[model samples]
Target chain A: MHEWTIADNLVRLVGEAARKEGLTEVSEVYVKVGVLRQVIPETLKTAFSHLIGEIEFAGAELKIEKIPLAVKCRDCGSKKAGDDLAFTCGRCGGIDLEILAGDELYLDYLEGKGNGE
Target chain B: MKIAIKEDILKEEDRIGAENRREFLARGVAAFNLIGSPGSGKTSLIEAAYRELGGELAIGVIEGDLASDKDTVRLRNLGLPALQINTGRGCHLSPLMIKKALPEIDLAALDILIIENVGNLVCPVSFDLGETAKIGLISVAEGDDKPTKYPLLFREAEVVVLNKIDLVPHSDFDREAFYSGLRAINPAIGVIEISCRTGEGVEEWGSWLRERVSSPAGR
Candidate 1:
């Protein structure tokens, strides 16, 4: 599934950090995923499991937080939680909304001193 | 051993892409990432562009595909700095590939660098290559509901070229619906109806291209 592909991205992120900073292993990885990104987390974790061995990120834990679809209505200027992909203002009929959150894909940090390879 | 470091991985990709864009802009060169589906007439449009402004404008192409360099050959035969990027089985082109290929491009002398992305509407919209404008190509035969079905790509595009209009008569689709759908997603987007085969609206696209590629910001 595309979820596994998403995990590959996470693993790649961690692997890159590990390789560049000169680490033998990674301990933890934190990510923020927004709902609007249309990505599934379980598949990403599964992909991470396989890719962990490539850069000595084996045994590293992946922590992710899902960001809700928060949008700002253009007409009312009120920020609200969007129900789904099709965003509309709940307070007003304004359909012009800006996404405030939930399209996030970031690697917050890494923790570990990998043995010198 | 436990070592804690703070980083954002997505930022890294964006940073690299931003850096590349900065470098081009610094030298007064602008780049466009061209995207669309197979047989959407991207190569044809490129050829038409070559005919119109290829003489006055200094253009280069980075063609991305899973296997063939046929498009690359076509572009090269016309005597331009054209390169082919074979992605093997990859569905889309990444900024990393562009970074690797930048060395072959002389940004100082060129007016435009067009990256013809793999022929897919879905995956390519997600990646940013530090392009100044994303030119979304959609043929009339592909169905006018495309804008509604692929809102992400339409939203990402600065200009949407409804190419291959000559075949519109043979297809059952609503052109107005396509425009309205796109406007619903993005009102400010520039829409041009063109047919590369008959040179219809090619001048309009080329004229718009000339203005952008010849601006002070562009080399």
Candidate 2:
């Protein structure tokens, strides 16, 4: 349900980037969503499709890349996959860990045609 | 042409939340963001906390709901300064909304501000509202698997309030599972067990709140 808000923010973000580049029509928008963000790719796409009718984003494609959860072990200094949700160090079975990734929600860039193209 | 513009979509929200944090510090106000599933006893816990700490601390509330001003009315009826933000169809309250509510609150006169986020385990955790701490509420009625199911909230929560412990005897709420689940995400997170109806652990919760609010080194 909140995917719409995410989509709206993404559009505004990409639109700003596009405008600064003098891009009149965006061809694609690439977004990276971390696992911890819990953003459904399909829902985001549907939300984006809903807003593509707007002149600025019309005909633009929404692309999303899912990033897995990763953590940094404080004891062994190892980066471990956080898929287990156990927070344990996969190397030494230590519990001291800091989340290194999987909370991201950002726009990577915009691909489009500039004005007068 | 492709522009190499890598930016966080929620950076604006983060910026606004930071500004709100500064304002809170300038006013000597301690704010907390309360998040959980709907009917997880957030309102009840707030009301209980108000009853416990209202005299010692000048507390205020920012109620976020999809619709209706019921929680706002309830808080205001308790004689505390309260503001309600109806997101309409939105799932969570953004820092911008919190900024809009700040004017309604007398920050200088407030000792604490509690933002009761829209009842959601997902969206509310994604947005920061400039609070000093994020507290997650889970009622025993909601099942013990909530923390496992919604790891993001538990992972980010500085404190987790397990409300309705009074019903633990009546319900199949596994205490071990809940605590272990929370520990799996955040090893050092504080967990408070309370029952608003029976006033079981309101004092503990209130004491934590008081400490957080009055301490010079606010968390």
Candidate 3:
């Protein structure tokens, strides 16, 4: 699954962050995934669990936040947010809509024990 | 202790993609990434374009597949400069791969570079390979509802190529539903129906490529 690729990136990013912040052990990792990405959380979690073992932060917990899809209609200047993938404007029924959000895939933060702790 | 990273996951890939884009722009080469399902005729479409525009336009190809270099051999046999990237377990092609492959091709001598992405619709749609445009391919055998089923590809693709028009008479593929579905996601998306098997509608696709090559601004 492509989730493996995403998980690989997550592990690398979290590992880098842990090293940069002088973190000996990463306990929590927060990630934001948009609906447009179509990443299944359970699969990504499984993938991370399998891959994170190779790194220093083997037991890091991944917390994923799903962002809903939002769009702005150019014709009628209406904005709509939905969980579905329909790209049509709900208000004006226009097909010319600008995507406002829901394409995000990023690491939000990392919580862990510092070198002294 | 919380460290706010706030970094995009694809930041590395995007960085390389931007670099690749700059290189293409500098060389005045129009690069197109072709994405579709396993049997959507992406390679065939490239072949058709080569047959039509190869004499006048200097064309090259970067073929991506899960394991084999079959597509590369096919293109090379036709006297086109071709390179293959076996992604192995990876589902899509990354800009880093393109960056590595670019050195092999003489960009100054080529007008168009067609990249045949690994045959998966979902993963490839998200990865940017620094192409001038992404051409989405869907065949009649895959059903007309594919556009709605995979809206992101339809929305991101510059033009949707409807392959296997030769099978339309035998299959239950509704052209009307396909057009409407594409419109719902991308109102201004261009569509070209072609059957690489029968050589139907390929000239139009060739013409589209020629126009983009001549006028990179139009891409």
Q: List the DockQ of the predictions in order.
A: 0.36, 0.74, 0.76
* TM-score values for chain B across all models: 0.92, 0.96, 0.97
DockQ leader: 3
Q: Candidate 3, what DockQ?
A: 0.76
- lDDT string, candidate 3, B126-208, tens digits: 87788999999999999999988888899889998999999999999999999988888788899999999999999999999
Best-performing candidate as measured by TM-score: 3
Collision count for each candidate, in order: 9, 0, 0
- lDDT tens string, model 1, A1-105? 334445666677677667878887677777777765555578667767677766556888888788887889888999877435445466885778888887777
Q: Flag regions of model 2 displaced more than 4 Å.
A: B216-218
TM-scores, each model vs. reference: 0.82, 0.95, 0.96
Put the candidates in lDDT order, highest first: 3, 2, 1
A6-66 per-residue lDDT for model 2 (tens digits):
8887777877778778888888888888898888899999988887767566888988988
Model 3: residues >4 Å from true position, as ranges?
B217-219
Worst 10 residues of 1 chain A by lDDT: A1-10
Alpha-carbon shift of residue A32 in model 2 (angstroms): 1.0
